[model samples]
Target chain A: MANLSALMLARDLKLLLEERSKAVAYTSSQTHSSLAKGLGILGFHPSQIRKVTCDDSMRIGTALLRSAIEQDKALGKTPFLIVGKAGTTNTSTVDLFIELAAIAREQNLWLHADGAYGASALLCQSRRAILCGIELCDCLSWDAHKWLFQTYGCGMVLVRHRQFLTESFGTTAEYTQDAAETGESLPNFWSYGPELTRPARAMKLWFSFQLLGLNTIDIAINRGFELAETAQSSLEGLKDWEILSPAQMGIILFPFHPHVPAANLDEVNMRISQSAIENNLAATLTTRVRGVLVLRIYSIHPNLSDDEMLAIINGLDQLAHLYLSRASKDDII
Target chain B: MANLSALMLARDLKLLLEERSKAVAYTSSQTHSSLAKGLGILGFHPSQIRKVTCDDSMRIGTALLRSAIEQDKALGKTPFLIVGKAGTTNTSTVDLFIELAAIAREQNLWLHADGAYGASALLCQSRRAILCGIELCDCLSWDAHKWLFQTYGCGMVLVRHRQFLTESFGTTAEYTQDAAETGESLPNFWSYGPELTRPARAMKLWFSFQLLGLNTIDIAINRGFELAETAQSSLEGLKDWEILSPAQMGIILFPFHPHVPAANLDEVNMRISQSAIENNLAATLTTRVRGVLVLRIYSIHPNLSDDEMLAIINGLDQLAHLYLSRASKDDII
Candidate 1:
């Protein structure tokens, strides 16, 4: 929504193309679906939104992005915005922000970092280095609910130039003239977002931070990293399991590769997850990596202990074996 | 945002207009700022949104709306939407929804009811008549947080057709194939709204309704109406005030009009509200009714008693006198 607001202002002021046909936006294949959904809401056609392919690390290739921009220009399309994912949901992969930022500067495209889940990692000194070039981006979105442990719907959008937001959303009317002319009070918050009557979403996070302190938050983030590392090492001991991607931040992707000739490994992996869910074990869902289904685990719960992690892994193994045995025997069918 | 989403769908499908130039939306001058802010976000210029004149009772004059639509058409603009204020935020005034709905039907325009605060009155048998033709609206936006007494940010949008939202927002991708093919389970909520990972806002309302029976909630709504009526009658007994609007869905609007050459009644009305706030009395505010500033009271707290209402009224009367007496004496000014 923030990026859409900026784009609309640019178009309204003739900074970008007045016609929708010439405007284009770039996003990595690993980017969250919300971006595509927002673009659709803003009246962008599927052809106007170009999904750039990611490399093995699931980061948008700078060379490929530059080529796509050149191609769009050659095709008479004006590229305007590039969205870089600070941490993707599927594999929790952080993009090459420094390189992406450089490209955005050279190409004059608005860079918005969709850090709904990963931006909070910047609180931890050990993990802050991973987001090296994030400061160079024009705007960034962060969801405090996901990482700061606040209640739901507490998302924040930060812009490098503060006036851009008000310039995009501000309106004048007799009812609101008093507040607007005061010229001394804080900006009317309604002029900064889509909604006029908004919830006090920041209060919850403010109280939480005041009570828990930043030191505790940093420790919780670091603990998540350590837990994911521990889970990966524990999974390495299981011969029938293949770790498709090692731990990043707090997420790991793996799939079941049993000894038996499983006709479909994707089906086997899905069954493993379904079996775990049916047994009421800790949830481990399946996501796609390069069009292949893999079981993904997000170990971000601060309350999770090593013993609990072991129990969940043991449960998955037992469930996978039971399903494989049933498949091999074919029962009476 | 919901209204904006529906408007965007109408424009995108060419049901409204093929381009932004000829498209226009009609809304009462008393409609909430959020709707106007939303239209602005969706690329509507200030000229594209026409604020039709309202009646003395704060209802949209249906005849005025019809002529406005005709004028826009004559000017080569296509009128597509007519928004009826189910309850204006300032006066809690209900528009002539039945007449507006009929005009929308005849003119082939989409009718949206902004009932964020008053729709919950439907649950009360006695007050439901005020929203006589609410069911005829094409879409309605209700804020559960306002009248349902739930936590903040629990708003709902009801579309006449179920598939319209999905058709507007749904996307096909390899990652979501499994759930897409099932076709028998619950709706993929992500496809129905803009955000992919929205907090479960409905759960709070569900729990509130489950814990508090319908009978109790109805009584609470009725109590709010009674409290406002009592406040209005109590204010009538005072000598230096005028009730601009009677109680409607728990909101009563009035202004201080003392017998003196006050010169600026708007400033006096604002001072009354400011004095109330400074004294730490009930948190009352001032709003405009027909271009005149008036003190508005929303007596929605169910636990407020008759005695407490009397105390608030007495406090206002005394505070108004104190300021007026200070002005009358011309002591040192």
Candidate 2:
């Protein structure tokens, strides 16, 4: 259903493709465009979404919100699909869930919280504020794997009401529909969402939950954010490099800068991405910036610390420095 | 997506049209008017779907498959959706998967195996034949919770080619797209099928697997099949009752004696289904032969023996005997 939710977000975001968020807390000047495309898939016309800006960074941060009120005013109920990321994937941004839930309740929208990354913080006393009002929202999607230490594809889409699921996709199969009170009494997963033959993947979460209490998970996740702060401090010495979105969990995005012309930044970044693989580093490279590519180094293991993160940063810097020195040697000729 | 599958099945069954799945999977057998609707969705026409016999169940068994060949000769590779049940929720009928897979390979068809129940028994060496040819098929779906001790929604949809998933519902997302990657590298899960924000429901299966190995699971599922067979044998002992489908898995179907009066039997079975909540027994009531209702019992545990199954059968008989005796008293008056 998160895929469906993302599609709805894409449908709504096409207007200005502005960086709109569902939450009122911590409005940013920039967010990822993936948010824009998420709104476009839900049948929202491009004209329905309008982009507004917050005074954040120019290139890296593009934060704006598509107000649900604008939708409710035009369509009455505004039957929309709203997204509230538990933790934003790119920038580790957390929108105000309580404020968004209030808006969802009053405006009559389908509020689906994308808690894929940050939801595990709910167990954290310090970060409980981040997950505020998740219960009030119509749906909450969190990735147990990203932060909660569940396996990959351990994502969730929890609908507030059982009827919403049944109303959305209930059907009877002659072959499978037992005339007895099979699902008429309870919610069958088949009627709830987009999958029928899905993996019995839920066991990982149940196992982890049983093996380690949520409190332990809470500390571990908080530790990730805690580690991010240390990483930010450690990288401050590197003048050429820039931290884009400081780590929410362990994921910290920073672009490598060479002491070369701006035109070659992209080319060098691509080289560094390949170099990371070639050199057998722990970090894999992904692009969040338009021209500038970033390498994200974050994993679930608590063993990773500031030293490991810095080693990667140092490796990238060394590679860029070498590339720039060769270029300068040619320039001197 | 399973909901859509169910909706298509429902459309084939013709009941509620509240969901998109129902709208998508409706077959021509029941909702004949909507026969061509799916083809149109797949970019085909009404005549594209081969018409099979509605009245003749024998034609549907295998000969209808032969008829599909003529259509295959013309289309080269027909985009077809096959619905097979490892255990049909109603009857527990095991479709011949290997035979269908051979025919599907010959026709180059998209064979979607729907083993929502009985497929859970593939872990059992004795029952493995029921799930044969699964790897060769284009896609397969099954729900683990129905037969296995796993929680609900632990389903699966396996695709043979990763390209099939990337192409069928390929995405055009702003955030997920790479200007450099083209159509080749790093295909996101969103492109693989449907929905964006989802849950780590996979862990549930992992938990079940960990808690109870596949060997245990196999034993449990085959035990359920054994219970169904026991019930069938006992019902066959009763001279009046007529078994409709003595299927392979947990569900048992038998008319309340087609030769005998059915009104009293219908009332008796409905009351039995209604009273099952209070009784706390093993059996439940289900209707399979259209409006005709019957008592269905399933054994979902490996520990459950033939003796226990026979005891439940005796209990159902005692309830029916009491109800029928009361009906006779009314008739005499």
Candidate 3:
């Protein structure tokens, strides 16, 4: 067992020394699994890479790559990334793609951008800037799930150098071959991945992408963004808590004022959202910020309306007033 | 940045400490994302983990937990898991749920199996062993996007520990609502997770699960297992390659025969897998035996029949013969 670990470690070191490391996992600290995997598959130790973030609970993967490249001389290592959405889960933050692409070119690194969540934002005119340099990336990823409103596991990794994926992920066994080593354009994607007999998971994504088309996605993106915008404005300074990050797309993060007592801000935000979710109401929560705790509500569900957003804001206002009153009484005591 | 890493590290340490951690994440090992994430989210440095393998990938996870208990002696710190099946990518590597449940009970750990790939096996009579202890699991995770044939991001996390999830992951805000300390019967899951206004990925999975019931799933599992069994028997006693682990449900791993000239089983298996994938076949490669390097396959599609598996096996057998012939000639020369 020690020998196995040693051999594995040695081979990894050899890859490091030989600099044959071809794939770079570009993940924002925000991305859950997509970015971490690029490096994991390429045989990297977790600490050997960087997962950069932009805001609280978001990652600026593009910026991190640029930083890696800019500091490559000092740090002595180049970075390849499987970049993804910056502030996802809440579908909020996004990385600086244009800058990351430029760094990819300068550093000769493979750039795999993951827009699985926010890339759905590409359909929107306002949010399109967030993905300005996507085409320039060596690879791109997006989820038919999440904002795409498709099935889960409908996440895909699109490599600009499709051949690289073929090189890294593809494989074949002649015994399993339907035919000989002849010249035919057989998809044999089985060779380009690490799994055999893969589920036809792509069909749903393809179906939904075609079914809804760009207009629907764009509208969804716009609506979610609009809701966040309205909620942010309506709830601003209307409470004891403060809003931290404003609505980027369809997310808002703020916390109950930190100086307050063990205020169950987490509990309160949950109640308002629960009031909505349980009654089949429309809303969601993302994460806590500034130790104050926050909520994020963003989506493209037709059920979510402007009125719902307004109600959400009203609920926040009411909660804020109650919290402030409670805090005041606590202060008096 | 150091602080963030420190916090992540601290969180991981707490997960490994003698105290039970919160919001356990149990998934099958075949889902590479879950494999990559086990320690990262738990807040460990990642080194302390040594993956468990059950000759098949199923054992790696169980082994890891056993290692934690026997090696680390952090028995009281219950670990979270996510098992997989229907979307395991490796169809045959369905988790030994009964064994895992036993382990979970013994260690006070939370079991969240990711049956995203192999879960389709649940519908089978012979493969019923895979799902034996499934109901006992604290949580069940599966990707509808895979075999149930949904689209991407169709992953579902089903919790048996309904109350625990609320306690572990519930949150809210006063600015959102105070609820008057009122009676909120059910808590919103948005707070129980790390997302806000999450996409309606649930609808797709819900639709499929409700529509299909278990009968539909059983047929697919039976069919896939048949294909795998056919493929394994056809390739038995091949010249250079041998089945390292034959299919139980759909996953198969075979290493190079010890006497084969391309002795580095990992390298040879990798090369064969790489070549096969480039040809656009329905296959790929992975390293579950870690350093052992074997050709692994997962047959999961209900659309595929046993004959298809035969065609694949024939192709592999031919390749092994060709390789052996070449080696013999080289030795003579």
| Candidate 1 local lDDT, A1-333, one digit each (tens) | 443554454444333325564678888988777777766666566677888999988899778999999999898888888889888888888888888888888877778888888888898888888787888887888888787887667888887665777777775554454466355366677777666556787798999889989999998888787788888888899868888889888889888887654457788888888788888997788888887788888888877888888889888988888888887788411
TM-score for predicted model 2 compared with the true structure: 0.62
TM-score for candidate 3? 0.50
Ranked by lDDT, the better of candidates 1 and 3 is 1
Please give the DockQ score of every candidate, comma-separated. Answer: 0.40, 0.13, 0.05
> How far is B331's C-alpha from truth in model 3 (Å)?
37
Single out the weakest 10-residue window by summed lDDT for candidate 3 chain A. Answer: A1-10
The Cα error of candidate 2 at residue A74, in Å, is 9.0
lDDT of each: 0.79, 0.54, 0.53
The candidate scoring highest on TM-score is 1
- Runs off by more than 4 Å, candidate 3: A1-34, A37-42, A52-78, A82-91, A179-186, A237-241, A256-283, A290-292, A323-333, B1-333
Off by over 4 Å in 2: A3-86, A95-112, A128-139, A158-166, A169-215, A247-250, A310-333, B1-25, B28-88, B92-164, B171-190, B195-234, B246-252, B255-263, B270-285, B297-333
Ranking by lDDT: 1, 2, 3
lDDT of 3 at B127: 72
Best by DockQ: 1
Residues B185-237 of candidate 3 have per-residue lDDT tens digits of 64554443433234566687678768887677677668777776777887784
Write the candidate numbers in order of decreasing TM-score.
Answer: 1, 2, 3
